[model samples]
Target: MKKSILTFSLAVSLLACSYAQNIVDGNKIPVAGNVKISLPQGFTTAIVAENLGKPRHLTINPDGSMYVKLARAVDSKGVLYLKDTNADGKYEVIKGFGNYGGTGIYTKNGYLYTSSNQEVFRYKLNANNEVADTEHPEKIITGLKMGRQHETKSIVIDNNDNIYVNIGAYSNSCQQEDRKPGSLGVPGCPLLDSAGGIWQFKANKLNQSYGQGTRYATGLRNVVGLDWNNTTNSLFVMQHGRDQLNTLFPDLFDAKTNAELPAECMYELKKGDNAGWPFAYYDPFQKKNMLAPEYGGDGKKAADASYINPVVAFPAHLAPNGLLFYTGSQFPEKYRNGAFIAFHGSWNRAPEKQEGFFVAFVPFKNGKPSGNWEFFANGFAGSDNITSASQAVYRPCGLAQGPDGSIYVTDDKKGTIFKISYNGK
Candidate 1:
């Protein structure tokens, strides 16, 4: 027994050494030094941490510390506090808080806020504005509905102390039969009453319910990415465009059209705003909200003017999951006030090579989108083309900007955090 135990310990030590040696040798992993991610000419990239288990949204503190939310609990711990004590651009100190997990997390005013799929909570902060009293967090909002699809609750807090949460529609198209081919859309989609929109509740208020909240916007199918744009003092969101355009309506749409129609859109939201969803979709090619075929559209008719249009539109099914407005001066001047969106990449664009497993930028001027959106960083997937989601090496999931103007990205697949900085090359 003693010899067996000794052998096992020696084997474990050898394995650890081999892994560290691989990293030192600049092999493909530990993924920090030579991860194959491509940034702009003047920017450099490094993996901040890895093996983080389904990391979701992340926020950087004023002091460059970070708080990340995981999609599920790890050893009953969901929230992570990370610190880079040595200033080596790698986070070395890691701490865990609360045995709950969800997709929303942020630090503001004097507290750290996080959420579960069906509730939102806040923890008091220490003097340094870092996490404190984590285990006994106060529940700010409760009783939210989370279904099987689009169940993650992404969150953002505004300047006025209002917190916004997305309640995604569970059904694919609000169809009468729900994704059944040839089924018509339910008129006046009842799902809009509860899901399919953003809701506003007081950030300081405790135990709030859906009945106590106000519907800020309607007709957004599923908004996984949203941010409070301080420049405009309003809410901005990226709507994941609906799917199966050709699979459901083969008579009207072809495989190529299904893969590329109905653009993923970015919208600057205001009170009572409505960005059309089940009833209509924005066609990037036509630059108009085309009536949905499920709603009697023959693939060409435009929806009425009652629906609000998007500020910017991207290719279909790219799954924009993170949004950050650059207020830092790290990169070139063009990046200031511009928006960085992390496309989680596409799983539905079958029969066509997938794209958008990278961070994209949309330049903004005077609080609105100014120029066309472009690729800010690429190569997250480690290849030029991929036919499926499993082939993706790292899917960009969340984004944040550090105090020195560096940007951070999170991957849900391997739970990796990547940091990108401008070196002024």
Candidate 2:
């Protein structure tokens, strides 16, 4: 027994020595004294901003300035700010305004667009990236719908300058009462009328009304992360899949499969693209699209052809909260025109393990995924263990690429912003 114990101790010591050398050589970032993982060479991480109150989304202007949106507060509604105080490629919070809460923020032709629960609004930005016209808080669109299930109002714009907003459904899996499984859906799901899809409106028009414009897409549970792909000239959205299969329907999904089965999806969306939600979810384990328990699909079979397959599918509950296509020359040539997704990590995979607290990269060739995805960054959980949800320090919820080719990630949990830049050493 003494010999065996001594042998194990010696092996561990050697491993620790090798890990320390790797960190000293700048080959990896040490998560702890004994463990480290590789990052891109000469790429350094720095905190650009901290102590924000749930900074959800970010956008960059024609100049080097940035605009950020905050969500929910006890006293104030929310604030949108312009940050360019230092001119060092970091936001210093120069000025801010807005009394309403919103997530989606974009600037086009001097107008800054944002959304509240049931409406979309705009403000004019000046030469310094500050709100120049506060009185022109035009309510562009109003009175769509809002509820607890998918209340985040994510908005985007296309090259032609049309505006799009993802108004999400108000239930989990179309349950009779939010997340309770096997509860039959409402006869036609009244929430479908005003919610559960993307709506399009004129970007320059004011006082635009909802329920009067065209439904761009339907059957989307919630599309929080959306961006217009310039190469394909199409919009892509990353969806948050539903949860708790076996706990709600033990007759169908086994506990292990339930924990790690469904494929969080990325879709190449055009007008009228119908992604299956509530009725189905993609099962990565089975390597096929499977019907949801509420819809009567067994664990291994794909649903009917009425539902569209995802262009790319990721592991369950990664919570892909942001998507951006890299359009800069600062990084290596391999990363241009690729997609970066900010995974907010998992919460429902409890007692099994959590996943996806890091950013991932998927290279694109001719507007499609050219290869398998890779973990571009890690260590956001603050530890390797993911057994509990609250232990995570930084959950990546948003992404933005600056004009100088640096990438920024925002964490909603701690409200921190990290700027990643290549040092070109």
Candidate 3:
């Protein structure tokens, strides 16, 4: 971790222009004025739009229009429809609609789908593949539980027309008293009954409820970032690991250990797979799943193998907000089936310097990770040192690929939309 930080810092220090070539991917990514973000070689970035009011998740249409679900609504409308009238690749025309604000937005099966904190809705598309009826969207799924904590309902759709939604657990760790020191976990976490996992429903079905949907997997505390990996033909999700280990269980772990112990896990989920949360967490440093202190195990004891392991584990609390599988042909061949994850960065890595305000790449081949994760984009924090998230200039919360094989990323803080494209070098 120290080596990765040092290398990234050195790269940032050396670059002195509007763009710099990333040695990893050999792409010349852009570095806008005062904003310190960077991308790989041959690839370039442009600020396509700005000030859209905290855009969360986004989707790009075949006609080069875009829809971003805002974290907060503007003028009673939550979704922003951006149109690129010219072929210069900037979304010059922007409009807003949809009465509520939330984290999920997607386009699938000739419809544009979105979610609020508690419901999933879809709008029909016309011949242009844009939302045909913005004012009257049909409710596809209803009555989703929103506990007001970890309650972002991210949405993903598979090729089979099954739409999966993440129902985040309300409690931080299912403790008898949440976030309090020495509080034991509840025996049978009731939170998992109605929350804490992904639920699957028919994308074409309307007005589906919990009884109508299937609990595809269980024991995920909260998942903000998820996508349908077509190459693997499976659902992949990013679980936000449980927090406050040192503050809650002071004797079991120290501040440094608390900051780094449990990994933010990425699981390639199948039907009935449980990536154990609240009960256990993956220790990336130890490379094993450790039993939670609330579950009556010492910090050193490993969790039982009944729980599924993550395909990859990342540094904890970086807030993995968006996940996209690269199927676009704009980049070199090495990036074809790999994954790009945008980290919203960390706030609680305190007592140590906060990290991870950047986009990361994990190379994959034939549906499996082939190499270690590396920073494909970096420097969103605006400085090498950051003790608080509010000090960071931009937070990349969402990702989408365009029809021309370029990619777009969203910033929830400044509401900036950036497009990264290949120059075909």
Candidate 4:
């Protein structure tokens, strides 16, 4: 019996060694040092978290735990929690707080901060990354303009501990009345004064109030995907471009050109960066930026000096909802510095057959885009015919990399968190 036990131990050790060797070798799978990554065969997705009430975004703690943000429509009272009860790469419910609102949640310097349509707040977190006490939520800023159009609130922090909140303009394109073209923009566009930009505030201070050393940047329409790029040590965002092309202007843009034109933009934002929204869009097909229809362009010429070109542009109406730069070493070397974008799919590309319902990968070298992106993962649509929105089972809205190097993708439409890992067996 003792001999049999010793053999079992030896077998276990050998198995562990095999896994280690596989991981070391898997790091070299992408031979070209490009964006192409081959997934290991027999790999399956597991649910590491669930029932997260329209989970919108997620961030990882240093210790492999995650803090997720949920949309207000599902739970009007506040957010929910999931703690890894067994430490087996999954989280179990531990605690929750807040009232129903479209706010972003993130952890920095032992504090968990959240933002609502009108205010930004923070709370103290325990060692486990869970809310230790919600006795009160420290209001960081207030008086942020909120409206129906582009109202989903999002927040992020920089290495300097400066908190940034996105206040989206209520109007579609700052039209004279809102969504109407050829109409003069409101002088100075009051929305620019209170919304349509990133507002900076002191993250460590409480009740310090709004409009104090705030106003870090301006001229952003609706930046839902915002993060501090560790590679460049700067803030980056993906903007959902203006919609209803051609229909809003037929003489300038036709159906096919409008469908594949205006590229969804990814910006490396800095102080005083103005990406033309109501004025222009980056046209990927023409391979040159073009002026927005509202400002009057024949869709052939580009307004060079008016707006900054995107570092990366994708197919229009793809609705890039989430962006993450992989810094973890769990994946292959080629993917170590690349960016992952979750496109919530196209709605306006109808009749031409909707597109962009999958996650895409953009290769990055030394903090800049190396080349055009490619579809990294497919089969999310779960069907061949996407005639209507109801037929889609998954619409990826959030992305997070686990401590173990597994990728977590959240489907807002179905409230599912898919954990993708390598097996290499």
Candidate 5:
């Protein structure tokens, strides 16, 4: 067979030159360079692209190209479109098209959008903005109501064309049977009317459904990171805090206060803003907003006053997912507009060693949140004693920002895509 196809094309060109000689001085990447991350002083990381399968939300391309979004499909496509063509920041061509999966992606104006836990599409781009009918997208919003524990929609877009979307809350505490440990909670949580919160629609309208969008913010209990913070024009989200909690109040939380009492918020929203899930939660050790033992709370109580609190919180189950907001400029100046967040770590926080798979930072100034939110990129769960989540090896989820001010992250476990840059030492 022609010498076994020339010995399998010379063993795939010597395994692509031993994976490009594992980059050395130039593109870094020894495990996403800066040696297992810990960025801050002069920054520096790489890896660019790797496996890529479950890569959730991502966006970019004003010309830099990225457009990810995939919680499933790959050969059946779920939108990929990488492109770097030798700029050396990595990417190298790649491509895929949309079919339907879920996670939520964005672009705006020229259009690109994405989503699928039950609909919300849109493509049309061309003129170099890429994606112009990658197999006809356009569904703009449909059904949307899938659940079994926070369905993973995660979308965002605002500049007035609107389009939010999040719909989680399938019951972790709205109880009455959901997390049935001591059960109870169900006085008002009518599943928050239709799955937790944040809805809003009409990004050029189209198929629209699920009561034609509008919820815009209600007791959010599962917002895999959202964005649209045009310097505080609003809409920020992150919430994913509400799980077990001492396996359902074992006589008022224990097991290390259920691995550190509730927290993991971030809010910022508006147009109704609720924040309190299943009655209330945010308790970074009584920073307050409590009352959630299925609504009778025994662990210190508090809530009421229509809930609302979190403008920051963090540190309970980690699992943030992704949310950017830097606004480019290549870095420095205290990361311009600030706010990165990508967590995606704890799978229930076992005995507690596993923390957010990292990529945090906050800092925003005139739009709120300034100072103290640190951890600009830490090691993506390559392991810090993660007792579970399949032993963890990269799980930061998704986040983008490159135009020059590099910061791409994505890594739904083994799908890589790092980046990080800074250099001005």
Candidate 6:
């Protein structure tokens, strides 16, 4: 027992030393405004890969290799594998495969799973955790409902061999006339019957459909960012709130109120949980869930008691595209078991300056948020006040943690992979 303890101590010491060495040797990359990603005092960032394609969701293997899913196919390939041939902390070897395109990619249980808009597929990995057969991935789930709005499939897998898939609602608020001004919300929101929720399926099952799985939660407008919290044994998701509040109900909301009325919410979910998307939205100022205007709400009415509330409510219009729970040791002690979210920036907050083009950190303890959320990384928008989406330089879309506890954020605009590391203070 003493010998075993001594060996474990030595291995941890060696790993700590190696981690420090990598930080000292890694190149510091500059981002927007010539600023180096404005991290907390002790951390630094580097660009490991750049200018590939429209990289969306990302997953880092235990061996430090990365698999990135693309929003659009590059040269007919939708997935890219990146590896650092040398120990220089730069991914030099790039390979692409899988002809389909979507926003979900994950590595788990000897398989690398990816999702198209309508299906989930997995490629078995080899002994090295690399894809064994990229050309022939097993279709795990198929025939998911798809539409024009929020069609990307975001996915998360739990330790219990269950996969959670997000099926976003196509309409803004399940209106009688979609996106039409002054249109009333359809009572009982029929869209929630099949979309606007998370569905669970067997991770290894082949060719499964909607009828084969169970609805895990409902009433979310869209969930591009979600993760299974291994520490709490629960699922957490970020919901994109309904849009065009002021335009749809001008008498109830002004432009400024529209910009900040609905709060982007993070919810710790369970079976049969409802967030009241078309009927209610979180009002950060009121600190309560407000009734949505389409449901006869005049902007001041609070929601009923049946809907679940968010654990964290962020500024309205910050499109949270990715979320991750920090289980890494390289960050400070406050970060462990906390959540990291990537805000893809807003396109609709026009009369007001755009917000949330950065990464946010929410500290949690014992399955609940213990501290105030703060920004961990910023300056991805390249400008402080964004009036248009095209004016932004890079939009952060995904987050992943490396085996050595480093954090990676992927930019969907330029396909840049930014690696962030911490050097002890």
Index of the highest-TM-score prediction: 3
lDDT of 4 at 388: 64
Cα RMSD for candidates in order: 12.6, 7.4, 5.2, 14.0, 20.2, 12.0
Per-residue alpha-carbon lDDT of candidate 5 for residues 1-425, written as tens digits (9 for 90 to 100): 33443453354335323422222223323574334766766778778888878888788886788888888887788879888887777785377987777888888888888888888888888889887568877788888788866787888888989888999988777888887688788798777887788889889989988687889788887888888888778888888888886677665555555665577888888898788787888876457887887878776659887877877887678878888888888788777888989888887756656677777888888988876576677766665577887766788888888777787888877777888788777
Stretches > 4 Å off in candidate 6 = 1-29, 32-35
Per-residue CA lDDT of model 6 for 104-132, tens digit only, reads 99988989999999999999999987886
TM-score of the candidate numbered 4?
Answer: 0.85
lDDT per residue, candidate 2, 129-220, as tens digits?
66777655888888868887678888888988789899888887887766775675555566766778888888888777766667888778
lDDT of 3 by residue, 157-259 (tens): 9998999999999999999988889999999888898899999999999999976999999989999989999888999998889898878876666666666
Q: Is candidate 3 or candidate 6 better by lDDT?
A: 6
> In order, what lDDT does every prediction score?
0.85, 0.75, 0.84, 0.69, 0.77, 0.85
Candidate 3 vs. true structure, TM-score: 0.92
Error of 6 at 388 (Å): 1.1
Clashing pairs in 1: none
lDDT of 1 by residue, 1-425 (tens): 33443453344335323422211112122243334765556677788888889999999888988999999989888999899899786786478987887999987888888989999999988887676677689999999888889888999999889999999999888999888888999999988988999999999999999779999999999998899899899999999989997779877776666777678999999899989889999987668998999998866689988999999988788999999999998789999989999999987766768877888888899998888777777778876679988888899999998988999999999899998888877
The 10-residue segment of model 3 with minimum total lDDT is 15-24
The true-versus-predicted C-alpha distance at residue 408 of model 5, in Å, is 9.3
- Cand. 6 TM to true fold: 0.92
Off by more than 4 A, model 2: 1-38, 73-77, 82-84, 87-90, 187-190
Any idea what lDDT model 2 has? 0.75
* lDDT of prediction 4: 0.69
Per-candidate TM-score against the hidden true structure = 0.91, 0.88, 0.92, 0.85, 0.37, 0.92
Worst 10 residues of 5 by lDDT: 19-28
